[model samples]
Target: MLVLKKVQGGESGLEATDLELVQRCLSGEQEAFAEIVARYKKLIYSVVYNIINDKQEVNDAAQEVFLRIYKSLDRYNPEYKFSTWSAKIATNLCLDILRKKKLDHVPIEEIKEVSSRLDTPEDEYINKEKSSIINQAVSELPDKYRIPIVLFHQNGLSYEEITEILKEPMSIVKNRLYRARLILREKLMPRRKEEVL
Candidate 1:
C-alpha cells in the first residue's frame, strides 16, 4: 500500500489539498492509488456494512467497491468532491449486492457478536441489544427509505449528494429521509414506552 501523504514544512496538508492526489494517481503514481484506497476504506466499509450486515459479505463487498472504483477512476469527474464521488460508488455497489442477494433482514445476533468486546459486560450487553434493535428496524424499511437513511444519517451525505448518487430529485431525497425518520420513530417509540412501563 502507498504511504499516506506526509505534510512537509509550509505544506498546507491533505485536507486543504483537493484533487491533486487524484491527478497524481491519474498520472501513474502507484502510491497515490494506495493513498486513495487507504483514505476511503473506512467510509466505504461503513457504507457497505450499513446495507449488508454479514461480516464476510461486508469484506467482500468492500473489496469489490474499491476494485470498481480503481477501474473507473479514469471516468471520475473532478467537478464533484472525491469523497462524495467515491461514496456514491460505494453506495451503489452495496445496493447492487443487496439486490442480487435479496437479503431481507439484518441478523440481530450478528450485531451482538460484532460488539462482544466491551469494557464492561453489562454495558456491552445493553449497547449490543440497542444496536441490534435499531439495526433490525432499519433493515425492515423498504429500499427507498432505507437507502436514504443510510446515505444521509449513517454516511453523512447531503441531500444534494444523495440526489446525485441515487439519481433522484432533491425533493424525493428529502421526502425519503423525512419519512424514514418518522417510520423509525413509530417503530421504536412503542418499544421505548414498553421498556419504561
Candidate 2:
C-alpha cells in the first residue's frame, strides 16, 4: 500500500499528501480513494479497535469508517484538519454502535500496545519507566481524552490544527489535553517520577 511508503520513511514513490488524495477523489478519481484509505488504515483501525474492544465490532467499525470517508469525500472540506475530522467520525460511530448494540460493559483495563520505538540498552529500561507509564495512562483515557492525546502527541498536531479537526471549541481541546497530562502524572507518580515533564 502507498501508506506503507509513509511507514518506510519515504522510500516509496507515492508522491502526495492525504489531502491531495482526497482532492483527486473528489475530482472523480475513485482510485485515489483507495490510496487515501490505505494511508490512514493503520491509524484508524488502531483507534477503532481500542475503543470497541471487540474483534468483530472493531472489524465492522473499521470497514464502516472507510465507507463514511468514501461517502463523505465529496464534502471533504480542505480548510479543516483531515485527521481530526476522521477521528470525530470514528469516535461518534463507535459510540453510536455501542449504544445500538446494548453491549455489556467489561473491565476497562484494556492493555493496548505501542509500536516499538528505537530500542534502548537494558540498563536504560528503568530510565524509560516514566515514558512507559505516561503512555499506559494515556492509553487508558476514555475515547474523548485518549483520541485527543493521541492526536496531539502521536500525530504532532498543533492545538489550532486539532481545533479544526475536532470541530470542538479550542477551550475543550486544551482542557482535555491538560486533564490527560494530569491523569498521566497521577497514574505514573507512584510507579516512577523521572522524565515526567
Candidate 3:
C-alpha cells in the first residue's frame, strides 16, 4: 500500500522547488516520490478526465501516469518545469488511450461547469445552459484543436507549455486554439440567437 505524502517544505524548512524534489527522488528518497505524487495527482487527474471523459478510467489513468513518471524520471530534462513534463506524460497517455479505445466523444454533462453565485435560479440555470452549450461545442472539435483548447483553457497551460507538451510549434498551438474558438463561436451563434429570440 503506497501512501501519498503531503507536499511540504524541504529539510531546511523551506519550500522545495520541483527540481529539488526530483533530485531528492533520484537520490533514493522514496518519500520524495510520494511528495511528487501528492503534488501532481490533481493535475494528472484533471488532464486525464478532460481527455478521457470517463470517470471510471480517470483514477486508473492517473495512477498509470504516476508510474510512468516514476519510471521515466531519469529521462526528465531539468530545463523544463516538472509540472509541464508531468502534464505532457498525462496528455500523451490519455491521447494514446483515446486512440486505442476510439473514444473521442465527451459528453457535455461530464464536463463540469464552474458555478458562481447568482442572484436568482433563472440566472443559474441560464449560466449552466450556456456552459453546457460551450462544452458541447468544444467536444465536437477535431482532436488537433480540442487538445490545445483543453490544455490552454481548462488546464491553464501557457501556449509555450502546450507547444512543448504537444511537440508542436508555438504558432501551431496558438493557431489551433484560435481555430477552436472560432469553431465554437460558429457553433454557438445560432443557439445564442435562439435564446435571444
Candidate 4:
C-alpha cells in the first residue's frame, strides 16, 4: 500500500544492505548473519517488546525472530523488501506469544517507566501519568492499528515503507493510521484535552 519514495530519507539508520547479508548467510557464513543481527537487534527488540512487555520475554522473542530469519535466508526474495519480510516474522511471533499467554487485556499502566520515588515528585508524577496514558491507549489498539502506529511514529517509518512492511493497500494504510490517532486521542481526552490539536 505504502510505496516508499523520497519522503522517508531522513530515517537512515534502519536501512541496511539486507540483500548482501542474506546472500552471505545463505552461503553458510554465520558471521555475516551476526552482523545483520547486530544491525537490526535493537529495532527488532523494540517491535517485540511492544507486544511481549517483559524484557526477558522480549529477548527470547527477538532471538527467535533472528533464528527464523536465518532459517529463511535461502528463501529470501529481494523483490519483497527485506525489512517487510523480517517484520512480518517478528509480528507473527509476537502474536503467537500473546495467544499462548491468553492475555485478555493488556496491562499498559504497568509498562510505563517511572523512577523509584526520586526527587522532583511533581515532574515524576507528570511523566508517569503521561506515559501510562499513552502506553495504555496504544496497548488497547488492535494489532493492525497498533503495529502501524508504532512503526510509523515510534520507529520513524514512513507510510510508504510501512505499507511495504505490512503488505497492505495504500488506502488501508492511510485509513488505519488516521484511525489509530483518533483512537489514541479519544482515549487520552478525559485526562487531557477534548481535541487533539
Top model by TM-score, which number? 3
- Per-residue lDDT over 1-197 for candidate 4, one digit per residue giving the tens place of the 0 to 100 score: 22222111124645336686677678776767777777677677777876667776877899999999888888887887776677777877887888898765443323445467764877777777778778878888887787788777766677887787777898999999999899988888887753344
Model-by-model lDDT, in order? 0.77, 0.68, 0.84, 0.74
Q: Specify the highest-lDDT model's number.
A: 3
Off by over 4 Å in 3: 1-11, 107-119
lDDT minimum window of 10 residues, candidate 1? 7-16
Q: Summarize candidate 3's per-residue lDDT along 1-197 as a digit string, tens digits.
A: 23365545668677577787788888998888888887888788889988888888989999999999998998999999898999999999998999998866664233445656544777767777777878889888889988888888888899889989999999888888998889988999999899889
**Tens-digit lDDT track of model 1 for 31-149:** 76777777788888888887776788888888998888878888888888888888889888877877898876543223344544544878877777777788888888888898888
TM-scores for every candidate against the unseen true structure: 0.82, 0.64, 0.89, 0.75
Stretches off by above 4 angstroms in model 2 are 1-20, 23-28, 53-56, 98-136, 139-144, 193-197
Where does model 1 exceed 4 Å of error? 1-18, 106-124
lDDT winner between candidates 2 and 3: 3
Give the TM-score (vs. native) of candidate 1.
0.82
Q: lDDT per residue, candidate 2, 14-37, as tens digits?
A: 467767777777788766776677
lDDT of 4 at 144: 75
